[model samples]
Target chain A: MMRIVKDIMARRELLVMLVIRNLKIRYKDSSLGFLWTLLGPILMILIYAVFLRILRIEVALPVLVTGIFVWQYLAMCLGDSPNAIIGSTNLVKKAAFPRLMLPLSIVLANFINFLFSMVVVVVYVRVAGEPFGQLALLPVALITQVALCLGVSLILSSLNVFFRDVQHVIGLLSMAWFFVTPVIYDASLINKVSANPDTQFWLNFLFHLNPMTGLLALYRSALIGLPAPALYLVIPSVVISGLVCLAGVTVFMKFQGRFADEL
Target chain B: MNSDIAIQVEGVGKRFRLRHAGTRTLKSVALDMLRPGKRTVRDLWALKDISFSVARGKTLGLIGANGAGKSTLLALLAGTMEATEGRIGMCGTISSLLELGAGFHPDLTGRENVFLAGAIMGLTRNQMKKRFDAIVDFADIGQFIDQPVKHYSSGMYVRLGFAVAVEVDPDILLVDEVLAVGDAVFQRKCLKRMAEFRHQNKTMLIISHDLNTIQSVSDEILFLDHGRILGHGTPESVIGQYESFSRGVTTSDLRREWGTREVVLTGAEFFDDGGRETSKFKWGEALNVRLHYEATKPVGPSVFGFALSDENGRVVNGNNTQIEKVEIPGLQGTGSIVLRLPSLNLASGTYLFSFSAHSADHQVNYHRLDHAFAIGVDAGKRFEGVCYLPCEWRLDREGAKP
Candidate 1:
């Protein structure tokens, strides 16, 4: 693990260059260019807002907007990460570098896109008259989410080189995960639905099992000044994210040696 | 490991598993799990116990036929792939041009790709900046450097790739057939740069099927056949073995005779001036190819022909009695046609002799032998190029009269 870190640090410039190249290629021919980043999350927010309004859910639009954008960032990373190693087979076959860099760069590039779309989050926050004090914790929540995304990206990219069905599976998995996370709906509503003590205990336990549940709640707390989730939920989310990150690196390094041959 | 060694491979090998059905997707893997008997997996050894070493400044050329593990070995040396067994130790930075523009991004401009390629090759940003102009100048694709590389022609792409590879100034360079891409002038320029690198004492591992290129640039040649080292020695000896091996393969492939039996070619032999049958001759020596044929039936005026091909199976020279307008009378018995030359005029290399007997009008081929006889030519003195032209060069000083 130390060696992998050293190798990555040694090739940090290459990692940055790959990320920049990804961003450049992403925006190269498109006329809307960087605006497309914000457009995706905004569209999802608008669609969800209409559906929720039709259903007459009382959740605030700013909270949905923030959740949708963060989820969009994760979705994009997961969607593209599977092809990262396979797509760069040319480099993988010709040059020797830390293969971790390929998926890491994908995650980082999507993070950059997420950062660009954060402007929409700020606007929504202002329009909804949310307090600014909780916004100070936004970076912490964002970092945790990035770590989670990076971990998942690393695992999926390496696996996809050998099993291409991982890419398709991720597509289906992301949709199911989006609904499970508090993206289109608020978590407090679920809390209200499980009003009985016995049902509430199981519902909360099941919700907290999803790392993104606490992450989404944390994002809401930071962006819209919603009440923070309980210590049990928040701490487990952070711990799970860190553990996934470690496992991602471990699994990636383990399987990366076979990438060139499989690709 | 010796400090003087640039690369050392000790019993290195690579094994690959071949699945009958590609398990490259989750669906196939699941199917494979459910249908256990349907899965077929075979093992292929791409390289087996390959061991060799190169000193710090020497160039080792790997020559082999296709699927001979040359690329696999180069990839291992480049550290792009790990050996399934054994060890490879190396000293100094290694830069490889396994394929032209292997890592180039089509959407990025040539200038951007230069930096990207350089970074992948372990060059720092400042180092690339310092050499960026030199790389572009070497590639010589002016103004195209700013355009997206996708717009660049194949030649331009290869030139840029070669330029970046050489400019990295790696202590050890691994090249695998990328030089085979560009035009002749660019190839010469690359060779010149390689020579300059040699002068700077850089170690090089080159894989090429072009015998001339390998002979000219490599200090030593390693010959591979079927993933095993067939021979390794100085270029002359190893290349000699490779030539013979290739000739053996071609001859064995062409061993079957196919032609109408009006006349059967009984024998073909090479002779020196002394009339002694031999398969070896010296450059510029008197050489003769005697073809013996027996007419099975009454035949019209016939022509006996012979062709001489170099080691690469390229016909360097050949002629027939009909083309020479030497008519022969109708024959019903055995006869021989001896094609003699005062001087072979060919360079020192193996040549394959093929003979054919046919009617004067070339309507019917009585019997034809393809690559039937192989001959070796040894140059008496050091010579260059394909064939000796037998000319003299006179130098006159500026103040002196010719």
Candidate 2:
């Protein structure tokens, strides 16, 4: 691990160049260019808000909008990470660098997009007259989210090498995860599901297993000034992130031999 | 091994398992994991037990027929893939031109792709900045350098690719048939640069079927066949072995062809006057081309000619049976005809003999082997070009125009 970090440090110029390439290629020929990054979340939030209004949930619009915007950024990064290695097979096979840097670059690149979307959240907070005290907690939540994302991205990109279908499966899984993570609805609605015993247990179990639960809790606390979620959810998210990251790196190294062959 | 040996390979091998097409999907992967069924696995060994060491300042040529595992071995040496069971020790910075434009982006401008390719080759941005002008200059695509590569001609593409690969001054360079795309002039320039690298004590491994170029550039040659090193020695020795292996090859050697004349050549073989089937022939040795031609009808002036060409398709000898004999005698038969050669004075190479049985009026070709048989010319005495000519030379330097 230290060797890889040191290698990346020495090749930091290439890393930055790769990141710049990723950024440029993303918006190279498009007329709208970087605006699409912000436009994507804004459009999604508007569409979801209209849907929620139709359902007559009567929930706070600001909270729902903030949740969707933040969740979209994480979702895009997670979805793209799985295909990062496969997409950059040209670079991976030809270039000699720390192989781990490909996914790390994706993580960093997506984090930039995540930072861009944060502007929308801040706007919502000011309009809703929420105190900025919760904003202090946003950074911790964002860090945890980044960690969780980095870990998951590493696993998916590595696994995609062996089982190419992992990219497609990741796409489907992220969409499914978005619905279950309380991105549009609050988890306190656990009471609504508690009306049914089976629904309540699954709901409770999902809150603990889903890393997005931590991010949603953090976003809620920051935007609506709600208290940070139960310590139980927080602890597991950290442990899961750490373990998945370890598993990702180990699996990636083991299969790194096969990447050039398969690619 | 020399003290400055820059590349070493010991028993390096690569194994690949061919999976069924149905198992390509993720659902199939999951189902196969659960069932654990016995699946038919075909193992392809791309390189096996290959061992060689290249000293600095020397270029080793890798030459072989198609599917001879040449590219796979190059990839293994380039650190693109690991040896399955053995080790490869590489010293100093190594860069490879495995495929022309392998690192290029179609959407980016040629200038942008140059930097991207340089970075991919492990060059810092500043290093690339310093060398960028030299690369663009070497590529020689003036205004097109700023345009996307998609707009450039094929020659421009290969020139740019070759330029970036050699510009970094890598200690060890691995080139794989990438120069075959450029024009002859640029190819000469590339060869000049490679020669300079050789003079500067850099090691190079090049894979090419162009024996002439390989012979001129490489000091040593490693001839590979079926994933193993068949022969490895000086360029003359290895190229000699490769030429023999390629000559008098069977019908399976039909790589690709042109000119459809319905001439399904069943077999082609060469032999000496004593009637012994062989491919190896000494210079100016007695040789005979026995071609088994099957004709549907008796066509007039059905010319059966054989032209021995160099690897680049330049003719050395082109003569027809009609020319040798006054009458080819009309053929309505499904039998065989033998065309004999009195002397084979062609230089050593894998020469292609393309036969064409055309009308005397140059109207229709009854039987045509566009590029059928390949013969090997053993080393002896000959000029270094397509054909060998008997000419007398006198010392006229004192009386020359100069």
Best by lDDT: 1
Candidate 2 per-residue lDDT, tens place, B1-402, comes to 446888888888899877766335666666667777654345788888999899877899999888889988888888787789888888889889888777687878898889888887888778999999999999998889889898888888988988999998899999998767787899889999999999998999999989989999999999998898999999988887777676645322653443334333455778988889977777888888767766655565566666766666666768876667657656666666677777776776677778776666667755566557766777587577655677788888688585
Residue B334 lDDT (model 2):
65
For candidate 1, give the DockQ.
0.72
Q: How close is candidate 2 to the true structure, as a TM-score?
A: 0.80
Fnat, model by model in order, equals 0.81, 0.54
Model 1, position B179: C-alpha lDDT score: 81
Name the best candidate (by TM-score).
1
Error of 1 at A128 (Å): 2.6
Q: Which candidate is the best by DockQ?
A: 1
